[model samples]
Target: MIVTEIEEFSEIRVRARAYLCFLLQRYIPNYVPEPSLDNIINALKILKKELPQAEAFYILDKKGMQIIDAISNNSEYRRGKGINRSMRAYYYRAVREKRCILTDPYPSLLSHNLTVTASYPVYDDNKQLAFIICVDISLKDLLKLFHPSSIDSYFGHFTKISYSFFSLALLIVAILLLMKGVGSFFIMAFELRHINIKEIFESTILITLSLAIFDLVKTLFEEEVLGRHKKREASDIHKTMIRFLGSIVIALSIEALMLVFKFAIIDPQKIMFAVYLIGAVTLLLFGLSFYLKSISNIKEEE
Candidate 1:
């Protein structure tokens, strides 16, 4: 959630900065009052039309006193006039650096709602600071502009919810498998009144399968629901695969070992099957090792 918020904020800031720069370059001195107050108000009107999310537009002189309030509402403009904003971070940063800046979301004094301020510094003919243009945007409107598509947002939310339910279902199945394994072992022990080698081998196989299911559930929950193993980088993908596949390799090796013992003592004729299982396990381990080595080499090259 934090990562998502950061990403959204970054996108909003970048867009606001670019748009402010465009406005400054194209609609200059007119907005600087060198042309006329009418020109400045017209420029502000054009900006408001282009960016509907912009709640208000104001031009502040180098002294940080409101020079012109071009907001649609006259009463609101009158109320905002002559306000000093020299101490505000957004105003100070833009004037000091002579650049455009987008401030983090802050509560608006008038509306008491979250707002982001985009400030652009205007320069006079001598390249001295002339005026600072400010645009007030609400956080809700900023998000709408950032996302743009309602369908994408809804689909993304649905995907997260579905993944959560899928992880929960896998967890329930794992628990049931574990219970089945334990119940089978108890039933056999009580009925036979003896712990025979064959019965022990069967119980072990059941328990191993239950364990494998549990491992899969854990991996799914961590990767999908908790997001503990997100694949952002090549190394992240490699680590996730290693953890998930390592469990499977261990389970397969155990099953193969059990098969070998069963064939050697109870059924010698089935020894070839055990040999084949061992060969498969060996090949899997070799492939996994090669993949890990390749990942390490790639990281070194980087």
Candidate 2:
């Protein structure tokens, strides 16, 4: 559940950060260089009404020491004064960057759930760091405020259902191919001496293709239905395509070899067909290699 919420948060992170920055910009600039505690709390109370989903709001000194107790609708999170937050990413990052920044989701000590903090640096009259304004929101609540089509939402549920059906159909097909390929070996009642080379090659091709399809199905189900986040690396992005193409290359190479052996033993005049198959396999290999190189270069540049 935490993983899903974190993944969901990532989708809406940009929008959430922009909205939080905008909110802070509207308020934090007014309270620079030492605002009274009551005044700050009153302002945060108004801000809380504007962003009712926010868990807590607080102020931190330039050095990341809490300036006052937190202002929150929930009483339990309202007493956190004097805590040093200098080591927190929200504090250090906002201070270092001198901008409104959102921290990544992490387990919250107060709420015991995934939480994200948006910190805004406040500059004084001399344009020196004065204080930091921070807002904490639970990951789920943050998504509710920002994500229009969250996985718990209607559209997301429909998408997952669609992917599940497609994955199930592909899984069935892979299972059928697997069964057929394995059954081929038993055609001679498990007698190794009676096994046909052609049958062995055909079974290998079927098994390879089935493995490829299964891999694709797994990738699709995990990414689309389960919302599993994969890295943007070249290998991760094009894994399914690489697997399918690799399987095709392997199967074709095997078929070409089988054809060459059969033609050499029977009709040497038709060896050109095997040559063509081998040439096609080689082209596929080249194409796959080129694809890998292009994506790797793109990743490196990024």
Candidate 3:
């Protein structure tokens, strides 16, 4: 029962956030003479007539229905304050949490300026809640994130089977390239079998493609992923340095292994190994240069 109640509350919040985003992004900027509740409402009404699609936006004062930017388009729409005469759930949540909230149902006559509101509590330079950003939102736009349409629903199923098959084939090819690179690098260095450089390059390409796909997946569901403040850990910079060192070491290890094979096994030649030495040394120098530059900058700041 408690879980259900929490879910219901969450739904309401999204609607509010949506409304807030709508107003702030689209209508709020029009009122340039210092932002206020009355000006915000006036901007919405102007937007509704000009744009027609914007008639759904609104605002509320302490008195019930203190201001609705629009109420004429919909038949059941009624303007002015409703029964409640205090701070709304949306307003209270923003003031309390200091975070943007986008909940369900949206700013509708049913809930009376409740619904999806995207609101951020505005803070003055002195760090006080001067106002709350409220936006009326569309619920349909939000739901497309969590439960996307199935493949069948997306492409009409078997009719687009060939497209799916083609993608699968590409994925398989990428995997093969990665495997070949890994196998070549391992074998050439392991004294086991012939190492193929072509395979290694193919693997690298596939790995890059796979990472791109993963990034795209994150992009598709980004709305839900927002709200959390990105708190960079103390170790972020340290780990970044370590990863840079590791990449250099591993890449050299691969090239060195190949050089050992080319000169020791196939033929006695110093030329092939010389470039590898230069690159390894150059990478180390690059890291050192960056470290020195950072130190210099810090000292200047101090």
Candidate 4:
């Protein structure tokens, strides 16, 4: 999965670079020494028709101040005049390096969507930097342009469907377990008249296990099958693991406590085994908690 995502990103970057070069070649020759309003308007029209994905086009002076704002007619957002972008990495890199560059994805100030900026340095007759031409491309559009084949899309759909089926199966199992636990409790309470504490303890463990299984299945359905999450990041993985482990720890602790109580009342000699079990589970819980915390801290630093 990681390798596939990396390859897709690399391919998109190459395609975006090529697209930016084509625009630079076609538009640079139309530059006038002292561009008038008509020149800017005509250039904007040509760019709008040629590059449909480009959100906006900018002509920035040597100092990285907007000289011409040829906002795309199809775009709902527009930029104000004379906005200084000298400190922006894209502006600095294009101006200093004198090369066409594609920027990493960032939130667009206009529409607040993820966007990538392709910048090219425009030089005048004296071979000095005259202006920087920038084209804004929405990340959504860029990804769609280089989207995977239908086979991959179909495979993804299949995976989600499989997850949904698996989750439904788990839900059915959980419900059956819950009904069994309830039946066991009723039998102990009414039929047996609560003579055996062990039976009650067993019923409680069954109920807890059933609830835990149901919780896990619900989480899987929401996160995987239903696509409730946008993407699974490091934090999401960490949280999922922590929740799963915590549930197990809680269930084990409850079972151990019940064992200890039963042993204390019936056979005190076997209480040592329950003590050891509780100690081991407690140690594991502490270790897992510490490990998760350290991992979370490291990811935050990164």
Task: Identify the leading candidate in terms of TM-score.
Answer: 1
TM-scores for the candidates: 0.72, 0.65, 0.39, 0.51
RMSD of each: 4.6, 5.4, 11.7, 8.8
In model 2, residue pairs whose N, Cα or C atoms come closer than 3 Å (at least 3 residues apart or on different chains), thus clashing, are: none
Off by over 4 Å in 1: 11-16, 23-38, 67-81, 104-115, 138-144, 147-152, 185-192, 196-239, 265-267, 294-302
Query: Which digits, one per residue and each the tens of the lDDT, describe model 3 over residues 1-302?
Result: 22322343454444534544554656554223345766655765665565333224445442323344334355454444443423566667665676655544545554444234455444445565454545443333333222132221332234236544555555566566556656656666776466566456445544544444333333322211221112334344444454555445555555555566566666767756746775776778688678767766876887
Estimate the overall C-alpha local distance difference test score of candidate 2: 0.85
For each candidate, the alpha-carbon lDDT, in order, equals 0.70, 0.85, 0.48, 0.73
**Candidate 4's residue-wise lDDT over 122-196, tens digit each?**
665567777777888776666655654211255556877888899999899889988988988777667664467
**Model 1, CA-based lDDT:** 0.70
lDDT of 2 by residue, 192-256 (tens): 78878888998998899899889989889988887774333446758778888898899889999
Report the C-alpha displacement of residue 212, candidate 4, in angstroms.
Answer: 8.1
Q: Give the CA lDDT, 0 to 100, for residue 288 in model 4.
A: 95
- Which 10-residue window of candidate 3 scores lowest in summed lDDT? 221-230
Stretches of model 2 off by over 4 angstroms after superposition = 1-15, 28-39, 60-69, 73-75, 81-101, 104-106, 121-132, 143-165, 190-202, 221-229, 236-240, 250-286, 289-302
Q: Candidate 1 residues 93-129, lDDT tens each? A: 8877878788888778756777788887777556777
